[model samples]
Target: MNKKRIPLPWTNVYGLARTLVALGTAGTLAASSAETLFRPVATIGDYPSCNSTTAASLFCLSPDDYSHLTWLKWLCVAALLVIASGWRPRITALPHAYINYSVFSGIAIADGGDQIALILSTLFVLPALGDRRRWHWEQPQEQTPETRATRLLALIGISGLITLRLQMVVVYLQAAVAKLPHAEWQDGTAMWYWGSNLDFGPAPWLDTVVGPVITSALGVALMTWLPLVIEGSLVVSPLLPQWLRWWAMGAGLLFHLSIALMMGLWSFALAMAGGIMVLCLPLGSTIRLRADEDVATVDTSPSQEAEPPDPDRSAPSVEQPQPSR
Candidate 1:
């Protein structure tokens, strides 16, 4: 009897998710100066050497000079760009994770987004290591038989993905539950206060458009409580049906987009958007490869009964077709 082939974990769904994360981070770093990102003179509490002591950060390996640090920052941007391009996942996975770690550890300024990026990038390494595809966006061809080693690797990748899902649940759950104890969130005036804040609030033009709604009692209640509801719903989204999961994905993305518009936290919004995709998007979903229409015809059935080998039949080719660009 033939063994059922194990599906590889690297799919276009995850490919898009990781690409968003890489692009968001790369955009942020590429647009900023090294001086703004790295401190000119390292204090005892926050030093460039701290990154080295904490982990094998690329930035830490650079010489303690402004020019060297700038060059290092560009190097990270290039690596992230490669990751965003959906190139060889096996080669870029660890480098992507390392870049995030380096930024989190060495950057003078960072936020929750940076923390999330670090975690996601690290977890992505598991699936990437086992993936045999040239690009992450390519679906595994059905003709390829799974070897014992490949099956084991796929299992490891699935475990990592499940862990990532649970982590996202915890993140959303914590965000909602933590807000319950706060007076602003409780009284439904949180949106008002946040909108009117001097820093990190809505821009002047945006405030003009949304100012009235945020200040009103009804709008404040809806704006404030809606986030809690949405976040709470996301925490339990894994238990939801596939259709509901898609809705949750949409709602979660809209929520983050609003945050980006209101508070100018583009990187944060992008990071959370990626987290939402991993949490709610089904892993089995595949992208339609226009160049390779045959992918759609590939049988993904879990098991099929095998027939006895015939001496007259020839062995199938071991080679696989090249994936479409």
Candidate 2:
């Protein structure tokens, strides 16, 4: 049997989603390492490090022990970078997920984005165990049982991506719903309070420009109601045409980008961006064959090729010419 190359684009989609989740988690952890590692509130020395909490943590050392925590953090970062770069993803995925789970476990408070990203990290491990082939560029041989299993694994991984997109839409819709009863969200004045705060708002220089604008009725509505509308729209975005779905995802991306730039929530932005990639890629669609493969098909049965061609009987018969003519 001749081996055929199958172009399964969802494999690439899954791979990209995996990379984004891994890299986004790594970046978020790296950004918040100081607090996660040694903060007074949730350091490795915290009372619940080993005994009280049900959550699993990598930082099980005594609060006084700083040396081991430092080494472990750096090692986790290294492993994350390797996963993000797509160099030896199968080997690094376990460590990436473990370290992230442990860190979040030890922390006093965890962001919803980070929690979801950690879950996605664990999900990628299943796909990594099956085949070491790179999904973004090439796929393994097709039609073999092993290849089919690998494809199944890849589908499982892509399902994780789909789950992430659904999770994001749910989160957004939930937020919007929660705000429905609040007068601030309804009157479009919520941005005024949020934008005026020094902790969550833009830096002093930028706030000077952004503050006044948000205080106005139109600006407030734009900032507050726009998100609600966008979030509601995203709930149905997956059902839209692929191009339109991408446009909706792009809008979500812009919303997150604005939050990152204006509100200084980089982790949330990155996590949302990762979810966007899952929807942007062609995850649910079937693969298309190359032009050369379009006209080529394998005949699995010898009898199929040996079958006689059908005769046509619909045409009119021509008159025979006489010998004298």
By TM-score, who's the top model here?
1
Q: What lDDT score belongs to each candidate, Candidate 1 first?
A: 0.76, 0.61
| Candidate 1 residue 43 C-alpha distance from true site, Å | 7.6
At residue 67, candidate 2 shows an lDDT of: 62
lDDT value, candidate 2, whole model = 0.61
TM-scores vs. true structure, each candidate: 0.84, 0.74
The numbered model that scores best in lDDT is 1
Error of 2 at 27 (Å): 3.3
Model 2 Cα lDDT, one tens digit per residue, 251-310? 888998888789777766776676666654344232223344457431110111111211
Q: Could you tell me which residue pairs clash in candidate 1?
A: none
Model 2 TM-score relative to the real fold: 0.74
Clash number for each model: 0, 2
- CA deviation > 4 Å runs, candidate 1: 1-7, 40-46, 49-52, 289-325
